[model samples]
Structures are given as structure tokens and as C-alpha cells.
Target: MCGIAGKTGIPVENIQPITDSLHHRGPEGSGYYADNTLQLFHTRLAIQDLSDAGAQPMQDESKRYVLIYNGEIYNHTALRNKLPEISFRSHSDTETLLHLLIRYGTDILEELNGIFAFAFYDRGEQQLILARDRFGVKPLYFRDELPNAFSFASELKTLRLLSSSPLSVRTESMLECLMLQYNLTETSGFREIERLGPGKFITIDMRSQRRQTVSWARPLYTRQYTVQTEADWIDQLDTALQQSMQRQLLSDKPVSFFLSGGVDSSLLAGLTKRLYPGRQLDAYSVKAGAAFVQEGFADDYAHAVSFAQQIQCRLHTVNAQPDLIHDLDRIIYALEELQADPACFFVSDIAARAKDAGQDVLIGGTGADDLFSGYRRHQALYYYNALDNIPAGLRKAGGALLKMLPAGKVRRLQKLLRLSLAPPNERMLQSFLWINRSEAMNLFSADLREQLTLDTIDTYCAGLLAAIPEEHDPLNQMLQLETHCFLAAHNLNYLDKIGMAHGVEIRVPYLDTELAKLSALLPPQLKMKGSETKYLLKKVASRYVPEHIIKRPKTGFGAPIRSWLQEDAAFRENLRERVMQVCSQWPEYFDRQQVERFYNDTINNRTDGAYTLFALAAIESWLRQFTAN
Candidate 1:
């Protein structure tokens, strides 16, 4: 809900631009606090207490500890109950967190349930502590190159404003971005910046200049199967989701809904209407316009209208047929990190419309799919695993038939077959990668490919794969990989950037603390029963949503980028021109001949390189904008 920046062993004036750059994130007010060794800057959004008392860079009554915090502490009131002996001045959650930290120290992170990225400067110990939420719903970026100097910010752009010299482009991360659609590790696209992983915290002692990082949380994936029946599991899911929604509705302002007509968003719409009958919530959905709507894509606007009518809530639609060439520059600038996701433009359109309608808080459904196994790929993998049980001759015959099918399903079956053959650790990672290792190598220029041979790309992912707990269910391991890599790296990161870019705060109730714990306990079989993805979720959603809506196919909330590339001449021309420009600028890194060949192949539908083409376009724009002379 806010932007926070701080540095140790640096003057306060040096970090002011970071605060100034993030004014959009917190336009209500701004504050600064600095001592000899520590300085902190805060831009306030004023979600909870719309008063001066809510202003951040706030301190407790004793003034021994100053805090600059972003995001809401939904259980702050409950936590305050445990600290009855403490005196307080304001009702702001910032003050509540300060008291909790003061009383319980870092252990309070485990006791609290909220999304946040905050910096607490302990004036008593002359130390600085930076922490992010358990799920990384909030982002935190930091740099630690200079001796005895440490800086942290809520966004990469803000962190860039604090740099002392030109930032080195991390080509390794750029390669990862092009291959995977997001960074693999904490390494940012820049060499000097690093993202703090979710559920982790870092502490720096100004006196000794010692720094240490530690994990404060790990999701509970026990696979205990506590419930007795499907009905019982449905009830537990309902209770968990409703409780999470109740807590997420803690803001003083009116929160609106993002209705994609998908079950996740539709469920949110129904629950909000049913729970807060008098609040008059408004739901917003983006429509792919006449020229942009791809074949077989859902008529989300129509479905959104029907559902809104069914729930009796107001509906708003944003007709999103954006000029990809016109918006590409701005979109890349906002993303900072190069992500090939053209879906960002659609989300940005929705956020802008919500802001224009005077809605500051928007609720979304992002984590449900990852948590409950709601992807066709998940179903395919489940059946593919069963292929291991078939006799060798039958499995070989099945593979031969899969190869003879048309390319789309053929490629899917091939991937599943390969995944079934891969080691357990590598299977999930392979499922999420956009391209295979050989294809990535083919796309890179000869010089870049040579360098890649020296430094293998999978090295970073290997470390993460080895880190998965041995006791976790295989499906739970897959969920963890998707949550950490896809959700955190790609989905959540863009949601934060695009939403904050429009001054709208997006809250995901399905990712609530209690709900996460509940999800961790359910058996994988219940998560995706036989061929049904999100089976339990569908059952729970059936209570509030119509059976038809709950049973609809998952046409995710996205524009048809593949169709656009193939059908829209102007968009394709724009993409080609941009890629060529980047190739011209960095001939050493990108082979112009290979790039043009890829473009032509994709345009003629000879190769399914739409995703790679999109990623290249994004990277080209980002480099031109950020690395300009």
C-alpha cells in the first residue's frame, strides 16, 4: 500500500530521489527520517487511518524504533490484544506492527498474517531489518556492493534511483528472462540489484557492519489428509476462503472486484456480494475488442455481465484493443524487468480503468490456480505419470500415436513424455520453462551461445530443485515450484508493478495465511481429482456461483497474443521493427540474420515462436529505454 526506501552508512539526501520516484505508489503523503548511521523514506497511501497519525517513517511512543512499512497487517487488531501493556497513540497498523516487533522481535512475523515489505530501524541497536511477506505478495529490492553500505526499496525503479554509478546489465538474467519469461533466482536483471526472496528477512548492524539473511517462513505441505470426505473438504475450503476474504476486506476504503468471468474471479464477486450485502461492490472485466478477440476465446465481457447481474453487483468493462506498438514502450518501462507476457497490457488496462473509476483497492484471484492445480498442463502431467504403470509395449505404441497427432497436442504429449522420463527434481522445472535448452541455444547468437556453454543456464535452477524437501508430495513439490517460479517471479511481480503503476492496490484473498495452510494440508488427489483440475475449488465455488460458471473451461484472463502476432499486420510490423532495432544496437549479442530468420518463420506460421518473439520485443524495448546513451 506504500513505498519504502532506506540506507545505512549513507546521507539521507542521496536516497530522496528513490522516495520521489515512487510517489505514485503512495500519493497521500510522504515522510523522511534519518540519524547519523541510518535513514528511511516513506510514501504513504493512507489505507487504514486517513489521518496524520497514519503517516509513516513513524515511531513508537518511546521513539527508540522508527518504522517505514508498506502493506496491511490484517490481524493487527488481534495482535494488539497480545500487547495490552503497551500504550499507543494511533490506530494505524503501522503502529501495531511496531509494538508487535518491539515486544516479540522478529518472531512476530510468524505470528502475524498480512502482506508487507518493511524496514525497521532499531535506534537502540543501531541496526536495520528488512522483511517481506511469507508469499512475497509485496516486492523488495536491495543492493549491497558498497562497503558498509546497504540500500533497499519497494521497486527496482526506485532502487535504480539510489545507484552511485551506471548499473551493469546482467546478461545472464536477460537470457533467463528470454528463455523462462522471468528471472530464475534473486538476481535482478541488473548485476548490482538483488530481490529478497519471499518469507525471508535481512538484518544489518550499522556498528559492526555485519549483515545476515535468514528464512522466517516455509509453507506447511504435510499432506495429512485431515478431512473425512469431499463434502467436509468443501466446507473447510469455504470457511478458509470466507475467512480470508473477511480479513482482506479490512481496508477503510471501498474495494472493488476484478471479474474475468473465470471461476476464480467470479467466486470473488459472489462472495463479496454475499458477505457484504450493503457495500455495493463494483466488478470490472476487460474485453478483447472486435479486432483483437481470438477464435474460441471466451466472451469474458458477456459472462462478466451475466455474473454481475446474477450477483446483483455493478459491472464495469474496459474495451482493451490497445495498439501494441504504441503501448510497448510504456509497458516495458513499467515492467522494468523484461517479461514476455503481453497479458501485462491487459492487466494494466484493467488497473487504469479501476483507478479512473476512483477505486483504490482491487481484489484479484491469482494464487488459486497454482495452489489448487487448475491448469490443463497439471492434468496432462497427472495422466502422464500414470503412463509409467502401463506395459512397455503399450506405452511405446501410445507415444507413437501421440507423435502422429497434430503439432499442438503432439508437442504437449512429447513434453509430458519427456517429463515422465526426467528425474523428479527436473520434471517440474521443465514444465514451466518456455523453451527447451537446445531451442534457447539456437536463438542465442553464436558469441552468446559460446558464453552460455561456459556458464550453463540450468545451474541456478538446479540449486532450487535440490532444495525441495524430500518429504513433500510430488504434486506439492510441483505446486511449490509453480508458486516460487511462476507465481512469484512472473504473475505476482507484474500484478504489483502494473497495479501500482495505476495507483491501485491489488489484494489476493486466496493467498491468505490461513488458506495457504489449509491448501498445504489437502491431498494432491483432492486438489485435482482424476481429470478435473481445481475439483475441490469448483465444489466450494458451487455454493455461491452457478454450476455452469463453476464448470466453465479456464480461458485465463489474458489477451490472445498468438492470434495478434499472426493476424494483426501492424502489430507484427511493430514487433519486427523493434527486434531489428535491438539487433542493430547490440550486434555482438544478437545476430541480425538469425533474428530476422526467426521473425519470418514465426510470421509465416512455420514455427511456433510467438512467445519467443514477444519476449524479444519486450527485451528490445527495455534495453532501448534503460540502456540508452
Candidate 2:
């Protein structure tokens, strides 16, 4: 993994500053290639081949096509078989991809697998291609506003470095991120920067100044895997996961594991042990304190110990209670663009530990929840169906009773309530968004609210849902949106940016192209059977993990938003200070009296604005660090 930057139709005095700024991502090597047509800068991390031959801004033997790539290509060796005609010097995947594009052109993206973001330039054709992996496991951002000028980078910070002027926040995107935990569209936090959607590739004709974007891949419900049986589904998932683990472990260095001891993380470490029983793997986890357990988080240290003992792997634990708020500023700045996920801190902490332990790569489990219908939103679909069958009066009575239930079940039922009130297109937000539309819009000043169109948000989501035909299952349709909006935009983006921030590369086995395809084919009934979420996954986990781990109540892998706001005195003070600061800075865009009122209401438990408060504080910090007048 590395950082990349390039520009077209603009004159540059130097690419040194841009390359230097991204040194954290790729501290090993740096290079640049420029001409009248294009300028490309690359900082390399040297994952595959440690020799000079692995250096990027690499070109074909003929030198007609040049490439600067980030990410590992697991199938590069296999792909090289197809390009036997080229006399190659380096064994690096970068060389493999360069030759593949030379032979097959842009049409090869659909067949390409692995997590990557890259720029491939064809000097002879005067065309440039910028592409991201199928699920956007790797991120790419570009600026195409200027008539004949174009720039692209691996992160938003590098794009800012290339800008001729200070960047302003994209108002709609900023508010959307605050309302939802992450941005739903390609629009970045800044007006001039735009995120490239997952599974997408854009071709730019440097000569004509015309660009065309195409979705070469997407979460497909092709029903291509025709295996049909409870046992068949279990076997298929088990086999695909093992195969994915094998491909993801392809690296020149030893790869470690991130073990929460939940079934997902345990299964990954468990399978790694199964794959190579003779070798012991290194696994890292957060030891959330008793104080954290009071906030309703899992005391994952015991579980981590259990799984490590079960697998005979070396476990390294990081104490979470001490550095929780201490790491906030560094993590917020590392995230660059604002993402309110508390997992960012946890993962960055894990990455730092992984780096110190001499491991350059860490295997993560992120996509299984979205792919296997493992969230409260998925559980809500079952409730939605049950509510649909009940009479209106009965449903109303049941809704009233749900309030009396225990706290844990109430959390799941709350999602059911959110879906019940929303339109079908917006139902996917049950898990993604923290506030309702009216509340979110009300948080904005009237002038800004008037400029924002509510229809566009639903329309974009409805379009993603439309990808799966109407005749298909409703849960699959919602899962498609969850993958595109939540998984791609939120989960995968942070994993890449924050992991790279510490010089640690995260490889997610579940997001492997073949494994994702297998998941797309598994029927919804297997994914969530009745109130159970990830039913098939648990069954697959049983073959490799302990029963205690498989059956644990799902404590999510995110920060405890409610408790952090209500119980933690230090964190609460930090939040209030930042919120007040932003209110003062953008008084024209936000009503200070209203925001303060909502925040106070949230702390007193009179309102559900903990998430909103946390996001606003995150935005305040990001604005202070990344934005300029």
C-alpha cells in the first residue's frame, strides 16, 4: 500500500512537496514522472518486492504506458500467466497490473480482484484511467472542476496539497456526514474534492478534456451460486472464507490478526491457525476497562485471551481506557475527512501496536456484517415483516410494549421502529443514520436547509436498491444499499485511511472478490433466519470457533455513543468545548442557541442526539485542522 498523486493540463514547478506530505503512507521510497501531458508522484511502502525493481512510477518495457499503484494484487501471479509475452524485470504486482492494462485496456477491471486504488496512463492514446477496487476497499479522490485540468490522489490531504487555493466545506456533504455517520455520496468534505464510488473506474481523455465514469463492479445478487441447502450454504461459506484468507495473507512480511474474540474476528484468527497449524500468528485487541463496561461495551480482553489460547496464537492487548481521549486529536487529523466512527480510534490504536510489533500487515473482519445481514437493521427487517402481518391496532399495542422491554432488546426494537416510520427507499438508514430527516434538517440554518434537497438522498439510495430487480428479496435489496452506502463509504474508507496513517496495511478476507461474490449468492433466509442475524456465518464459525464465542450477544465494535456523552466526564467536557467553538465559528450556518439546547437535551436523556453531538465535535476538529479560508 502507498500514496499516489497526479495532475493533467496544469503546469507544476515541482512534485516534491506533494510527495513529501504523503510520506507517512509510504515512507520507504519516492519518485515522480512528468511531461507535457501528465505529472505523477508516488511514495512506495514496498510490500511485495523489497528491491529497487519494486519502485513505482514504473513503466512497461516499451515505456508506452506508465503506472503508479497502491494495494496488493493477490492474483498477480495468475494474471502474469496471461501476459507471458512481456519480458518482465520485477516480480511486483505493479508491473503485473501495468502489463494487464497494456494488454486488455480498461476492460480488464471487471476481471481484476484485490484491494487497490491506482492511476494507469497511456501516453500513446492520450487517455488516463483512475480506478478503485470493487468495494472501494481502497479509496481514490479527484478534482475535475477546472475546464481542462484534472488531479487525483490516494487521500483528501494530498488533494488539498495540490490545490491552488484554500478548500471550503461542501455544505451538503458536511451536514450529510453529521446526520449520518459518513458521507453517502462521492462528494467529499471539501467543495473541490470528490470521492470515486466503489467498484467504479473513470476514463479521462486528456486531449479532449472529457471524462467518462463506469461502475465496472458492484454488489451483485446474480444468484450465480446455485447451491441450495442448509448444509450446502454452510460448506460454501466455510470454503470461500478459507480461500480468501489464503489470498489475503500474500505478503513479503508476516501478517497479524485483529481479534475481538467475536465470531467474526475469532473465525479469521481461527482459520489462519487452521491454514497453517505449524505457525503461530500475532493477534492484537483492545482491553476495554470496567469503566467502559459500565458504558455498555464488551470486556473483550477475556474473549481475546480465550480465542488466542484456543488457537495457540500470541495475543497483544492495548489498554483502551487510558488513551481513549488522548488519541482523539491525532486520529481526527489522521482521518483527514471527518468520519464520526469511534472505531477509528480503536483501529488506529491497533495499527500503532501492529507497527511496533514488527507486523506490516493486519487482517481485519469488516464486510461480513454488511454482506451477511448481521446488523440491527437486518434484524429489523424480520420485525418489519412480522409487523406487516399484524393488524394496525395490534402493532400499535406491541410498539407500546416494546418500551417496557430490557435495554438490550430495546436497542434492536428501536431499529424496527425507525424502519416502520420511513419509506422503503430510506429504510436502509435504520442502521446508518443517527437522527431523523426533520431533526437533521432542523439542525441546519433555514438558508442552508432550503438549499439542500431531501429528494436527492432518497433518489441516490433508491437507484442503488434498483440494481437488484424488484422480484428479488427485499432484504437483499436493503443489503445492497448497506454495502454501497455504509460499508463502502464508511467502513472501508476509514480502514484504508487510518491503517495507512500508521504504516500498517489492513487486508480484509471477507471482502475478497470471490468471497464477496459467494456472499451475494447466499439467499437472505440463510443470512438472517427469523430474529437471528448472521445465521449462516455463525454456522460456518461453529466449524472453526468455540460455542461461547459464536453465541455471545452482539456488542457492536464501535464507541459507546450514549455513555460517552452521559457518563464520561472528561469526554463530555471535550465535546462541549468543541461544539461551542464550531457554533461560534459558523454562527451564520448554525443557530448556537438551538444547537446548545439540543446538546443539553441530549446529555439529560431528553433527546437522542448523542450521535449528532459526537459528529459535530468531530467536524469542529476537522475544520480546525484541514480547512482554510
Candidate 3:
């Protein structure tokens, strides 16, 4: 709920500018700690204590340790009760963390449950320790130079301001942005900054300037189940989800839910309605313009309205229009880099409207799909698991042959073949794979291709695979991978950026550490029964939502980018010029003629490469914006 920035071995004057860039993140208060070798600044949003006592970079009573922390510790009250001997200066979680670190050292992270990105400067130890939440819900980016200095912040833009070096394009990162629509790891479109991976901790030694990165918590895919019945699993999920919701609802400001007509949002709204009846909860949904160019891609706000009506809550529908263009530049600026994805635009608009209405805390059902096997990819996983019976050699041969077709045709054939040959887990992974070696190579310059490899992607996927116990069931392994990797990295990161960009705090009940741990122990059959995705979730949701709503098909929060690029000449022209200019110097990597064909087809309503094209344009825009600045 705040922005933190600092520099080690840098002048205080140099660090101040970086901190100033993040004022929007913490408009309530700002503070800085400076010495000859280090300067730390914190922008406080003042969620928990709303007092001067909660101001950070707060020091321990002994004044030996100072900390800049961003996030909430839900169990602060419980932790406080256990340590009555410690006098708390404020009712903020920041003080609670300061006390815990003093008492337990860095090990205090394991005892807490919440999303966070924090830097604890141990003046006593002459070391700085940076840690992110177990789920990566909050972001922390840092740029390091060996033997002397480093800068860390909540967003890359703040870190960019601290960097004195010229910004260069990281070719691999650029390709990732263009082809995958997002970078796979910490490497941003800019070569100078890197994100701190989730569940990771980095320690820096001021004297040596050496840094070491390690994971304090990793996903442990344990399948030790004692519950024997589906009903038992449902009961456990219900209890966990409700408790999680109650904990996340602990905010002084009015809380609202981002109600998409989907099952995830509907279920959250239903739960909130039941928990606080007659509270007049505010529910927000995006309804696209009726005559908008991409009318067919509009969200079904009727479903969202009906659910809100059923709960007797006030529903606010925001119509997305072309005139919203003025907000696009600001949104891109806030994002620090243009995403070019229309979804970013929509979410930003929603958050802006919600913030304008004076609502601070926003709740969304972001982690449900990853937790309960709710995506089409999960269904593909079930099919793949059934196909494990097929001969490996034959399956490989068939797969290779299928790849000869056009990318779309090849994808369909491969999916069909995977359904007939692999396990559900493998299918899920394949379904979510954004960039292949060939695609990456095609998108990246030769020099960049030589320097970069898909090793990070492989290692990330491998870590998930290794987490599964050898004896665990296949379905459980798939769920474990989705929860640990896909949910933590992709879905959670998306929600965090979009929500925080508008100063809205979004909490995911499904990703509650305790709830996820407990749910992991449920029998796989209960999670996915036959072809039904999120079987257990539906059963638990039945208690809150109507049966009809519970049975509705899953529709994701995506924009009609395909239709927009295909028919909107102005949008297409902007996208095409950006893409062409950025990639013009490296013709070997990208076929300009093919790119033109792709854009023309898209604009003429002949192709759905809109997402891909938009991603490319985003990377181009990011390159131009960051480098020029």
C-alpha cells in the first residue's frame, strides 16, 4: 500500500529524485533516511494506523534496524498478543514487522502471512535484505552495480530515475514483450532494471557490494490428504475462503469488489453480500459502448448487474468509449511502460472511476482460476493426462508433423494431439506457454538471441515440476503447478500492477497463504471431477451464489483488441508505425513485409493477431518512452 525507494553508496541528492517519482503511491506522507553511504525514502499511503507513528522508514526501539515495507500483515494483531513485552508505537503493521525483525531476525518472514515487498537495512549488520511476498502480489524492482551501489523501489520507473547509465534495449526482453506480451522474468523492456522475483530474498553487503538471491519460501506440492469425501473437501474450502475474505476485508476505507460477470467476481460479491448484509456495498463493472467499433467483444454487464441486484448492492457501470484516449498516456506513464493491451486501459479506467468515488480498498477474485483449475488450459490438462497411455514415440512423431502447419492450425493440431498423449499437467503448461524457441528467435535480433536463452522459462517450469512429490497423483501435480507458478507469477502480477496503478488495494482471498496450503491437501477428485473445472469451488460457492450463476461458463477479462486493430484505422495506424519504427533497424529478426501483411489483415477484419500486434506495439512504445526520457 506504499512506494519505497532508496540507494546504497549513492549521494542523498541523487536518491531524492528517484523517491519523488513515486509520490502518487503514497500521497499521505513522505519520509527519508540519509547517511553518507545510503538514502532511503518511503511514501506512506497510511492504511492501517493513519498516524505519524506509522511513518516509515521506521526504526526499531533500539535504533539498530530501519525498514521500508510495502504491504499488509493480516496477522499483526495476533502477533502482537504473543509479544506483550514489546511496546508498539502505532497500530500499523509496519511497527509490527519492525518488532518481529528485531525479535526473530530475517526468519520473521516465515511467521507472517500477507503480500509484501520490503527492504530491511540492518545498520547493526551493515547489510540490506530485500524480500517479496510468497505470492509476489506486491512488486519490488532493483538495479545493482557490483562493489558499491544499488537502488530498489516498488516500480521500475522509480529505479529508472536512480539509474545514471544510458537505457539500452535488452533484445531478449524486447522480444519477450513483443511475442509474449510481457517479459517472462525480472528483465523489463529496459536493460537497466530488474524485478525481484516472488518468494525471493536478496541480501546486499555494503562493504563488498556483493549480492545473493535466495528463496525463503517455495511451493511444496505435498498431497497428503486425510479428507475422504467430496463433501468434506467442499466444507474445508468454504471455511478457508470465508476466513480469508474476512481477514482481507480489514481496512479503514470503504471496500469494493471489481465485479466481472465471471464466476470469480460473482462469487466474491456473493460472499461480501452475505458477510456484511445491508452494508450498501459498491460493485463496479465495465460495460463497453453499444456502437463502439468492437461491440461484439463487450462484457456481459447484465450478468454483473443481476448478481449485484440479487445481493441488493449498488452497481456502477462504466461505459468504455473512444474518448477515453486522454487517459491512455497517463495510464502508460503510470505503468512505467506501455502494455498496449486494451485490458490495461479498461482496468485503469475502472480503477480511476472507483478512486474518484472515494473507494480505496478493492477486492477481486484473481487467484480462483489458478487455485481451482478453472481455465480451459486446466481442462486440456485432464485430456493430456488421459493421453499418457499413448506410445511416446508415436506421440512425438505426430506432434512434429502437426507443427508443419500454420501456427494457428499447428496449435489446434498440437492441442488435439496433446489431449490424446500427455497428462493434464503437461497440457496446462503447454496451453499457457507464450513463446516458443522459434517464435522468440524470429522476434529477437541475432546478437540478442545469442546472448539470451529460454533457460529462465525452462528453469521456472522445471521448479514447478520438481515440486510435485513423485508419488503424488497427476491431477494434483497439475493443480500444484498452476497454483505455484502460473497463479503466482502471471495472474497475481497482472492484478497487482493494474490495481496499484490507480492506488487501489486489491486482495485475493484465494491466494491467502494458509488457504492455499490447506486447499493443496484436498483430494484431486474434489478439485476437478471428470470434466468439471473448479468442482469444489462451485460446491462452496453454491452456498452464496444462485445455482444459475454458479453454472455460468468462464469468460476472462479481455478486450476486443482483434476487432479494434482490424477495423479502427487510426488505432491500427498508430500500432503499425510504432512497431515498424522500433524493429526497422533489425530487419533480419522481423519480416517487415509480413508485419505489414499482418497489420493490414487485422485492420481489414481478416485476422485475430490483434493481441500479438498490440504486444509488439507496446514494446516499441516502451522502448521509445524509457529511452527518450
Best by lDDT: 2
lDDT per residue (tens digit) for residues 476-559 in model 3: 666666655556545555566767777777788777888877767767777778879889899988998877777776665666
Q: Which stretches of candidate 2 lie above 4 Å from their native place?
A: 223-227, 322-326, 393-415, 421-423
Give the runs in model 3 whose Cα sits over 4 Å from its true position. Answer: 14-16, 289-298, 322-330, 337-340, 385-414, 417-428, 434-436, 445-456, 467-486, 585-591, 597-608
The CA lDDT at 23 in model 2 is 92
Q: In order, what lDDT does every prediction score?
A: 0.80, 0.81, 0.71
Each candidate's number of clashing pairs is 0, 0, 7
User: How well does each candidate superpose onto the true structure, as a TM-score?
Assistant: 0.94, 0.95, 0.89
Residues 1-629, candidate 2: write the lDDT tens digits. 89999988765676778988789889899989998979999998888988999898998777888999999889888888898788889888898899899899878887777989999999998899999888888888999856888888998888877776567777777677776777775778887788898888999998998999998885588555465889988888899998888888888888999999788989998988998999878999888866567756777779889889878899998777534355666777777776788888888889999998889899988888988887777777777766766666665676677756543325446556646755655566445667767777777767777787665557777778667664367678777887888888888888988899988899888888898888878877888889899999999999889898888877777777677677778888878887888789876667687788888877766566777887887777777777644
Q: Candidate 2, overall lDDT? A: 0.81
Clash pairs detected, candidate 2: none
Model 1 residue runs over 4 Å out of place are: 12-16, 289-296, 389-414, 417-424, 453-468
The digit string of per-residue lDDT tens for model 1 on 248-319 reads 999888789988888899997798778888778787888776544453456667778888888888888888
Error of 2 at 56 (Å): 0.7
lDDT of 3: 0.71
Looking at model 1, the pairs that clash are none
